[model samples]
Target: VRTVKPELVFEIGFEGINKSSRHKSGIALRFPRILRWRHDKKKEEADTLENLKLLLDPSNLSPDK
Candidate 1:
């Protein structure tokens, strides 16, 4: 994750050319400053690989993508 750090994650979009054909992809994220930390939650309860993929599904992301 350090290799991608703060920049590389932005390469992806909820929708668009950036949403490529890879089986698994990483996307850029913003608004983390205003977001809540999951410190109260355990790693098992936090976002997982499957959760990220679920967020990318066409039915999940807003049309603004």
Candidate 2:
């Protein structure tokens, strides 16, 4: 595997996300895939950790919500 600098950003699609101790970020994504490269967006515009954590909210996971 080739490792590179975090110079690019991509729009990722995932089935689910949850908190996980196994990961350094304490978050885990389920079946994540690269939806597309976000060429229109700068790397700085990527979603923040706080924003991602919002997905873990119980209210957000409800289908009726």
Candidate 3:
């Protein structure tokens, strides 16, 4: 049998990492969920690991605190 993959992609911004798991390369998103879908973009055009790391960088966090 053939499996169908999801075509939708989303952009999410969260507070911070709440947990880190030992599963799956020991990397996981914190409180991640569907923020939106980029129907106009192909899967290859989606955000990558580097992008996620950049967003999660400590220097990039808000200065409110």
The TM-score, computed over Cα atoms with residue i paired to residue i, of candidate 2 is 0.76
lDDT of 3 by residue, 1-65 (tens): 34446466677656564223443422346566766767788878877655655545565344222
Instruction: Order the candidate numbers by TM-score, best to worst.
Output: 2, 3, 1
The residue-by-residue lDDT of candidate 1 on 1-65, one tens digit each, is 23333311221223322223332345433322323444466544544545555555564354334
Better of 1 and 2 by lDDT: 2
lDDT of 2 by residue, 1-65 (tens): 34556789989999988777666665678899999998999878898878998789564453323
Q: Each prediction's Cα RMSD?
A: 8.3, 5.8, 7.3
Best by TM-score: 2
Which rank order by lDDT, best down to worst?
Answer: 2, 3, 1
Q: Candidate 2: misplaced stretches above 4 Å?
A: 1-4, 59-65
The TM-score that candidate 3 achieves is 0.49
Where does candidate 3 have its weakest 10-residue lDDT segment?
A: 18-27
Task: Give the backbone clash total of model 2.
Answer: 0
